[model samples]
Target: MRALTYHGAKDLRIDTVPDPVIEQPDDIVLRVTATAICGSDLHIYRGKIPMVDDGDVLGHEFMGVVEEVGAGVRDIRKGDRVVVPFTISCGECFFCRLQQYACCETTNDGRGAILNRKAITPPAALFGYSGLYGGVPGGQAELVRVPKANVGPLVVPGSLGDEQVLFLSDILPTGYQAALNAEVGEGSTVAIFGAGPVGMMAAACCRMLGAERILMVDQYRYRLDFAVQAYGVEEINFEECDDPAELIIERTGYRGVDASIEAVGFEAKGSVTETVLTAAKLEGSSGKALRQCIAATRRGGMVSVAGVYAGFIHAFMFGDAFDKGLTFRMGQTHVQRYMVELLQFIEDGRLVPDAIISHRMKLADAPRGYEIFEEKQEDCRKVVLTP
Candidate 1:
């Protein structure tokens, strides 16, 4: 089998690798049908997350047909079409009981390993991610071995194309969870940082949740313009505005946004200092978007973060959050909690997940797809690949 492998910073390749087989009784081998490259994957691609092994598979968002199932997997049978969540979880755990699948105690192997090596506690194992997770082979290949198969993979019964359900594995659920964390409701005004795929998806979700006005913030004209055109969202190009936070405040008559969301993870742009800090290994990420998110939220408002942070930030607005009584919610999305509802949304014609795709290619062209997405080339918003 040919799988996309991460060689090092800014280097990815298609390499021949052994096919996967069911290892655990609850595991299953999936013949991958479609996969999408996520923005989080860029963090590893640029070596921002350095714990990745050289031969690790390079994807997390995918859907496939079940080729084989372990003895314990009874609900899912061979030839079933399914979309697996990125987080591996045992549905019977305490966290799973609370619907917090991302924090399942039984799947913290990656967190324990990372704590042992770097003294940094990570979340549960993420597919195709670094050793910070379990180093589970990702879905960006011909076939993949899925753990916790009974609870992780959602069986898709519709005749819908893979693109419609592929995002259910990651970004769709991630964006929906991010919006849920913001607590947006009727007449609420929300400001979300980043016009990337996740940010826009959050906007769509907020709209569904009855937000009156949604502000889309980013420096990229292409992305913001797409968000505006696609989601009927208001645009806030940070480059055009002197101060995004202040502008948002002024537009809202000084009360500020009712909810603020940060969708830009680690590699936030717009600051030379943060860039230097990142390159020098002096800071975790730019954190500029988060700073703006804090500044844009009204007092007593909620600030939700869906963007991933691989390390600690040197500076955070703890004082501002404290003074404003802001409620902060962040974590890896408990994808299993929302996959079914999102699929229903798609089936009902209320959401069109595939509208965000800007590029499509074969699995072998994954390197080029990664380059195009990382560089924002050709107005790329998202890329979907097939084997």
Candidate 2:
């Protein structure tokens, strides 16, 4: 089997590895069809995600066909097409019943803290991520071993395309979760900080939720243009104006938007020209757009931080949130909670997630796909790797 292994910062490769097998009665093996390169994966690529290690397979967003099922798995048979949720979960846990599958007790321990801890054994593990998590190996390979197959649902809807259903693994559900977090309503005004695939999807979901006006913020002109021409979203390039918040408020006639989405993850900061990456200061948050979001949002509005934030976050003003009575929602999106409905949305032709995928390549060319996405090449939104 060929799998992309993580070595170090900016180091990854597709190498032949032993094929995975169903280890437990509840486990199942999947033959990878299509997988996605996520913004969260970038954290590991940049060496910012400390848990990753040499020889660890790298990928989470994926959809595939079931190859083999363990004895305990009865709901899904071999050859069933399914979307793999990024978070491996056992659906019978207390948190899962509460619609919090990300914190499933049997698979993910102690509210996501267990995965981030440096010292956990095989009984508690995470796929693809290194030591910080469970290090169970990822899906960016020829085959993936699912720990809790029967409970995972392995959805098979006849109407949805594989490309469309694939995003349900992470970003689509995440975008839907972002809108839900922001409490986007009919005729509401919404602003999103990043214009990447997830951001664009958030914009699309906002539109579906009946937002009258949608404002997308990004430094890149191509992304801004895409938002406008493709989705009828309003674009705001932060570099063009001195005060983005003031401009957004002005555009909304001083009422400000009803909600804002933060889609940029660790890369959420000033432009490369402004970010001084010294040894002492590896990463620092100017948080200009987020601050602008707070300022641009209507009083009592909702601010959803869907962007990935690891380790420590700096320069966020707690006072501003307190003074404005802003409702702040932030976390790794609970994709399992929304996958069913989002799959229906895709089936209904209401969401076009596949349109955002601009690059497609084989597993052998996966590294090149990473480079293109990292460079943010013109109009590059989502990159897909086929195994």
Clashes of each: 0, 4
Who wins the lDDT comparison? 1
Question: lDDT by residue for model 2 over 1-387, one digit each (tens)?
Answer: 999988888878999999998899998899999998987788788887665668889998887888998999878888889987877777776777877776665774322332355653222235676665567789899898988876564566756667978988888988889999999989989999899888988988999999999998888898888889877888888778777788889999887899989998656666454266422365443465677778888889999988876443455667887788899998766777898888778878899889887888898888888878888875677889998
True-vs-predicted CA distance for residue 33, candidate 2, Å: 0.6
- Global lDDT of each candidate: 0.88, 0.80
Q: Note the residue pairs that clash in candidate 2.
A: 125-134, 126-134, 128-137, 128-138
RMSD of each: 1.9, 3.1
Q: How accurate is candidate 2 locally (lDDT)?
A: 0.80
lDDT of 1 by residue, 145-217 (tens): 9999989999997678889888999888888999999998899899999888889789888888899999888
Ten contiguous residues minimizing lDDT sum, candidate 2: 108-117
Over 4 Å off in model 2, which ranges?
109-126, 271-286
- What TM-score would each prediction reach against the true structure? 0.96, 0.92
| Leading candidate by TM-score | 1
